[model samples]
Target: MPWFPEFSSAAELARREIRIAGQADPVAQYFTALNEGRTDALEVVWPGEVVIHDPRAGVVRGHRELRTFVQDNRSWLAEHEARIEIMASTVVGPRAVVELLAHVRYDGREVPWPMAVVAESPDDRSVVFRTYCSQWPVDGRRHVRPPVFEPGHAEPGDVVGRHLGALASGDTESILKTFVPDGYVAEPIGPDYIHRGADELRSFYTGTFSEGGGIGLQNCTMIDDGVRCALEYNLIAWGTHAVPPQAGIAVYERSPDGLLAAVRIYDDVEPPDSR
Candidate 1:
């Protein structure tokens, strides 16, 4: 079976109970609120608190802010005539990550924007949404996103863990050994930077580890379902240099042979040289 299945539509916002038919994802209510410009449904889904970490809107909390945020987004989407399409969905534990492709008419052209949203339910009442995407599709530059969550002890295991561990070790041979021959790295900015195959992966990692050390990420949360491991982290250091903390999330997909198939990253963190 495929790791990422389509987020089922069988579940309804009005139904709070999780059924064998589908998982009771609060994200459904989130989109519904945005579309209808109403927070009542959202309040029903998550009665206690709704915290959103949005690239454009920053951090939104509580009912009042959520309502305003929803209304504003609804207006913006209506103005831009945005159409969001779900690409894939991965559910693990209490967190569900949904990848979406949104198209908006801009400068007389419809631009495709890719995004991933992590919906984490800590308990039965509260939920947090961390939206990972590049604003470059709309505005031609990367926005520097600051840290959202403090570092925690949520480390990944298995092949996904091996990849991240190799990354921090700055071992090119070790990292390359973890990926399948045809594995690729998909950049967060857009699809234009997909580095595939052994040679391309080697080149990408070589430049990445050139600063004398490997990329260091502090684990904040991890959601793994034995196939795709979704890790939310704070990039604390790159190479020997201790850089400013930046928030990011990555999904590591495992091939059938227990090797990495692909690594999809989502972040707006520009390295020191870029800035």
Candidate 2:
């Protein structure tokens, strides 16, 4: 038996319940009952009013339609041994989206099919239960696909390395060049404090780097969308134990000049404050 942990938020709790149970799909029995046309076995864990966001059909407003969708999928189970293989799941606010790739095994054939489901809690607190039995097939052959990476996404390690190199060389101008001019650090629980222009950003880096100590960027993580970029790096200033392990995220937006438009930093932000 898997442990179904409860969450403070009702939606999270419900999502957790489904996740824990589906970890190994013990509820295949429940689906077995439904596929066998036993409506009594269709136990709904939904709240009074639940919203279903299906990737194909858009939004389903009530539990009845959701239940009907459940009823509709019963025939597929009769064709193969269905098991829920969760590919990925993300929880945000009072909602969670689950991606499951169902694997089917039957009659000397196997295939895989993908399905996405979204759960929403009416209030911020709600719990849910989910079961699975749909499956397609998984052929024995492997599919090799080309790797996809954004046009210019730099590894956090490389970025940190370059910044450290600039720090070591006392190249304040180079360090400033790395960050978008108007770059601002993503502050926790507060709005960003803009650094205004490149000169200010250069000053900020020059002051921090010139403290006559070995600095390092640790636990660095970088994320980017073609247009904008983000990075979280820890700043450690060595002398006088002056620098704390300040975990901060920098948000960069490009200017028309192809330079950084703004820079902001939330010095008060802490490590655990980030998700």
Give the TM-scores of the predictions, in the order they appear: 0.86, 0.33
Q: Which ten residues in a row have the lowest lDDT in candidate 2?
A: 142-151
Please write out the lDDT profile of model 2 over residues 151-263, one tens digit for every residue. Answer: 23335343444554665555777767766545543222222223445776666555554544434444343444433344445554442243445443344444555555543
What clash pairs does model 1 have?
none
**Best lDDT goes to which candidate?**
1
Candidate 1 ranges with C-alpha deviation above 4 Å: 1-23
Local accuracy of candidate 1 as per-residue lDDT tens digits, 117-208: 98888887788988988788788887877888899998777788889999998998899988999999987766778899999999999988
Residue 146 shift from truth in candidate 2, angstroms: 38
Give each model's whole-structure lDDT.
0.83, 0.43
